[model samples]
Target chain A: MRVSLFALILVSGITFTTAQEKDELPALDNPHNYIKLLAQDAALPALQGEEKFILRESWWSGRMEPGKAKLIQVQLFRRNAYQFWLAVPNRNGEPIINVYDSEGNLIPSESLNFEGTNIVSTMIQPEITGVYYIRVSLKTTIESPQDWAVIYAYR
Target chain B: MTRFFLFLAVSVLSSQWGLAQEAPVKIDLEDPNLVFVSDSVIPIPLEIFASLDKMGAQDWGRQIESRDIRLDANRSRTAMLFGLVVSEGFIGVQAQDKESVRRLGRDVLALARSLGVSAEVEEHANAIVNGAGRGEWEMVRQELDKTRQTVINKMKELRDDELVALVSLGGWLGGTEALASVLRDNYSAEGSDLLNQPELIKQLKLDFNGLPKRARRGDLFTQVSQTLEHLESLMRSDDTGAISEGKVIEISLATRNLVEAIYES
Candidate 1:
C-alpha cells in the first residue's frame, strides 16, 4: 500500500512539472510572438477603410516591470495622423499607453482597449511637428516582469 | 502523503497570493526621471516625405540627385552610403523617376554587397527595380523601406550596432537635406516645423560618438561628427520649437554639405 501511494505521488509530480514546463516555455522561447499577434489584432481596424495607415516596418520592444513605464521618443510631423499600439503577452495584465508632447504635456488621443486583452493603443495628431514620447506601463497583478512591444502606423 | 499534499497546497496558495496582490501603484507623472528612456526609435525617411507631400511641396523630381557610388574599403562608409542610396530611392519614388529608381536599386545592391549582406538585400533590390518599372510607386516605397530594414536587421544580427546606427543616420541626413531644400524654396511655419528635430539630432550625435575608434578615424566620419555638432547647435538655438526660414536654410546648407562630403570623400 505504501509503495503504491509513493509511486502515484511521484507520477503526479512528474506530470505537473511537465505541464508547468510546457506553459512556461512559450513565453521564454518566443517572447515576441504573442505581443506581435496582439499588436496586429489591435491594428487591424485602422489598417482598413479609406484612410488606411501604413505600418512602419520596424517596432520597439523591451521588458517592463509593473508600475514602471518604458518611454519611446519618436518624431511626429504636423500633417500626419499616427496610431500607436502597445501589446504584451496574455500572461501580463492590460497595458497603459499614453502619448506626450515635447513639453511633457499629455496629448489627447483616440484610444483603444478591449476587456480581457493584453493590449492598449492610442492615436495622436500633433499640431506641431516635433518629438513625442510614447509611455507604456503594465497594470499587473503578477510580480514578474513582462515583455512588451510598441508598433505604430501613420496615414 | 501528507507532506506531498501540503506542498501542492502551498504552491497553489502562492500563486493565488500573487494574483491577489493587485493594488495599483501610482506613477508620478511629474517626475522627470520616472521612466528610463527605452530604445531610440528614429523616424524613417517615409514619414518626412509623406509630411512634405501633405504640405503640397512640389518639385520632388528636382530633389533627386545623381550619385556615383565610389566603393570604399571601409564598411562604415559603405553602410552610410547604403542609407544615402535608400533615401535617394525614396526621392526617386517621390519624383516617379523610373530610371533613377532602377539605378538607385542597383546602387543599393552594390552597397549591400560591400557590407557583405547582398544575399539578403538582392531580392528587395530587384523588387524595387520591378516595382519602379511597373510604376508602382507605393510598392517601390514599401520595398525601399524593406530594403533598409533588412540591411539594418542583418547588421544587428551580426552585432554591428555601429553600422546599424550609421545606416540610420545616413538615411535621416539624406531625408533632412531634401526636406530642408524643399522648405527653403517654399517656406512655411508648418512646413519648417518638420526641421525642428533637435532631439533626433542629439541622438544621432550620440550614435556617432558611440562608433568604434577605428570607424571614427575616417575623414568622412570626422566631417559627419562636426556637421552633427553644428546641426545640433542650430537646432537647439530655438526654444519655441519653431524653426525660422533662415534656420531652415542653414540646416539645408549644413546637411547638403555633409551629404556631398559623404559621396565625394
Candidate 2:
C-alpha cells in the first residue's frame, strides 16, 4: 500500500521526501502542500473581492489528534482586516477555527465554511491591536490524527 | 474528552452567534497543557509597515536613514544586515524615495553575494532597481519582499537555519524600530497598542537562545539579547492594557540604538 501510494504521488507530479522524525504519519508526508492548496482555494472569495488583501508568505501547519485543538498566536494590528484560512486535506471532519484576544475573550468574526470542502475561514477586524490566538480543531468521530494547515491574509 | 467536546461545541455556537451580542466565552488562559505551536516563521516587515500607514503615519521619508552596509566577516551578522537592508528597502518604497530604494537594491545584492546566495536574488534585485527607476513603488515593494524570501528560502535549502532566524530577527528589529519611532512622534493609544507583542518577543528570545555558541558570542548579540529583555518587559501585560507613550519612546530609543549597533558596531 505504501509503494502504491508513493507511485500515485510520483505519477501526480507531487514530490515526497523522507518524513521528518517528528512526524508520526509517514504516509501524510508533505500534507502541507495539499492543505496549502485548499487554504488558497478557500481564500479565493475574499481575494477576488473589492478589498485588496495580501496573502502572507508565512503560514502555520501541524497535526492534531481527534477532539484536540491547536492554538497559534499572531500579532494583529488594529485597522487592518485579517482573514485566516484553515484546511484539513482529504479528511472527513469539520474543522473549527476561531480567534481570541489575549484576555481570553473571544473576538467576533465572520466565519466562512464551504459546503463540500474541509476548509474553514474567519475574518476579523480587530478592535484593538495585540496578540490574538487562533485555535484550530477538527470535529471527527474517527480516532485517527489529522493534518492541518493555516494561511492568513490581511488588508 | 467529553467535557472538552462540550466546551468546544459551546464555544463554536457562541462564536457563530456573534460573541459581541452574546456573552463572551473565556478560555482557560492558565491551562498548562495549552501549548501554542511555536511559530518558526516570523512575520515579514511589510505587515507592520502597512499598519503604520493605516495609523496616519506620515513623513516616511524622514524614517529612511542611510546605513553603512560594509560586508561583515560574520555570516550571521551579514545575514542579519541583509534582512535590515531589505526592511530599509520597504521603508524607501513607503517613502517613495526612488534613489534610496535603488541604493538599497544594490546593497541587498551585495549582501546576498556576501552570503553566497546572490544568484538566487540577483533577479529580484535587478527588478527592484528597474521598478524603482520607473517609480513603480508597489512593484518595488513586492520585489523587495521577494528578495528577502528568496534569500531565506535559499539559506534554508543550504541548511543554515541559524542564518534564517537571524535574517528574520534583523528584519523584525528594523521594522519594530521604525514603528516605535513613528509612534513616538505621533502618540496615540490606538497606535501604541500595536507594540503589545510579548509573545512574539518571547519567540524571538527563544531564537536567540537557540543560536549556536559561536553565533551568540558577540557584542551585537549581547546588545540584541538585552534589548529583547527590555522590550519584553515593557511590552508584557498581565491584563489587557495599552502600551503607554513613555514606553513607546523607550522602545523607540532601545530599538534605534540596537539597530545602529547592528549596522555600525
Candidate 3:
C-alpha cells in the first residue's frame, strides 16, 4: 500500500509539473485557501458566545503528501478549553489531527481520533499550561498534493 | 457505514468525557513520557491575557510610560522595536490611554525608518495616531494589528526572517510584561494562572534557536534568550494549576527587566 501511494504521488507530481510547463495554473492555487476558509466558517459560531475566544488571525496553511504530517506548535493555556478546527480540499485526502505534549507524549483527547472525514475538529482541556503540538496529516493518497488549513480558538 | 462509525466514535468520546469529569486530568511537568516532533508557532501572545479583565487584575502600563530608547541602526533591532511599539499600542488601547497610542504611532514610524521600511508602514502609523487623538480605540487597535502584519509581510519579502522572529519575540515579551505587572499586584489563583505559559516561552526559545547564528549572537538577543530560558524553567517547575505568589513576583521582575533590556537598549 505504501509503495502504491508513493507511486501515485510521483505520478501526480509529474502531471502537475507538466501542467506548469503548459502554462495552465495548478488545480489548487494557494493550496491552503479552501481549508483556511473552512476553519474560519467553523469558528464563526464558536465566536458567537458572550465568552470570547481570540482567533489567531494568521491561519496555518501547508501542503502535505499522503501519509505525511505537519506540526503546528501552539501554547494551550491551562484553565481554558481549546478547539482546533481543520479543513482540507475536497477529495484531496483524509485529514488526521493529533495533539502532543512538550515531551512528545500524545495527550489522550477525544479529538485525536479521525473518523474518515475531510473536516475534523479536536477539543482538549489542557491539563497544564504549556506548549502542545497539533499534528495535521493527510491519511490517504490523492492525484495531487493536498493543501490543508487549521484554525484554533481557546476560552 | 460512515454514519455507524460516527455514532460509535461519538459514544466512545462521550465515555471518555464521563471518565474525565470523574477525575481531573493531572499533568506532570517532570514526567518523562512527554514526546513530540519539531513544531511551528501560531504566535498569539497578545490575546493570551483576555481573561485579565474578568480576573480584575490591576492595569499596569508603566514599563512603557517613560523611556529614552537608544536604537542602533540595525535592521533586526528596528524590527523588534517595531513589534514592541505595536504591542504597546495594544496596551494603550486596553488602558484607554490615547496619548500613549499616539506616541507609539510615532515610535512605529521612527523604527520603520531605522529599518529602512518606513514607506510601507507610515500610512497605518499615521492612522493609528489620528485614531488615538480622536479616541477611536478600536480603530487604533485594528491599525496596530495591521501595522504589525504589514511590517512582517514586508520583512518576509525582503528575506529578513530574522527580523520576523525578533518582531514575534519582542511582541510576546511586551505582552507578557504587561500581564506579569497586572498579576503582580492582584495575585489570585486565576490571575496568577495567566503567568503560567511554559509553551510560549518554549516557542520563543525555538524561535531564537531557529535564527541564523549571525542574528542570534548579539548581546541583546543573548539577554532575551537567557531571560526566556529562565522563564521556561520557572514555568516547568510548577505543575499545579495554582501558581505561587513568589513565583509570580519572580516572573514579573524577570520579565520587566528583560523587556526593559530589549526595548530600551
lDDT tens per residue, model 3, B74-126: 66666667777787788888877888888889988888888878998898899
Clashing pairs in 2: none
- lDDT of the candidates, in the order given: 0.79, 0.80, 0.68
Residues B142-184 of candidate 2: C-alpha lDDT, one tens digit per residue: 7887788778878878999899889988998888888789889
| Chain B TM-score in each of the candidates | 0.85, 0.85, 0.80
Model 1 scores a C-alpha lDDT of: 0.79
The CA lDDT at B174 in model 3 is: 78
Task: Name the lDDT value of residue A126 in candidate 3.
Answer: 76
Residue B242 Cα positional deviation in candidate 3, in Å, after optimal superposition: 4.0
Specify the highest-DockQ model's number: 2
Query: Which 10-residue span in candidate 1 chain A carries the lowest summed lDDT?
Result: A10-19
lDDT of 1 by residue, B1-265 (tens): 9999999998865543222112223434467876756467667767887877886757888888888989979888888899889999988898899999999999999999989999999999999999999999988998898889889878988999989988998899899898889889888776777887888898899888988898778777888998999888776435565688888899999999999988988
- Model 3 chain B: which ten-residue window has the lowest total lDDT? B16-25
Best by TM-score: 1
Greater DockQ among 2 and 3 belongs to: 2
lDDT, model 3, position A16: 29
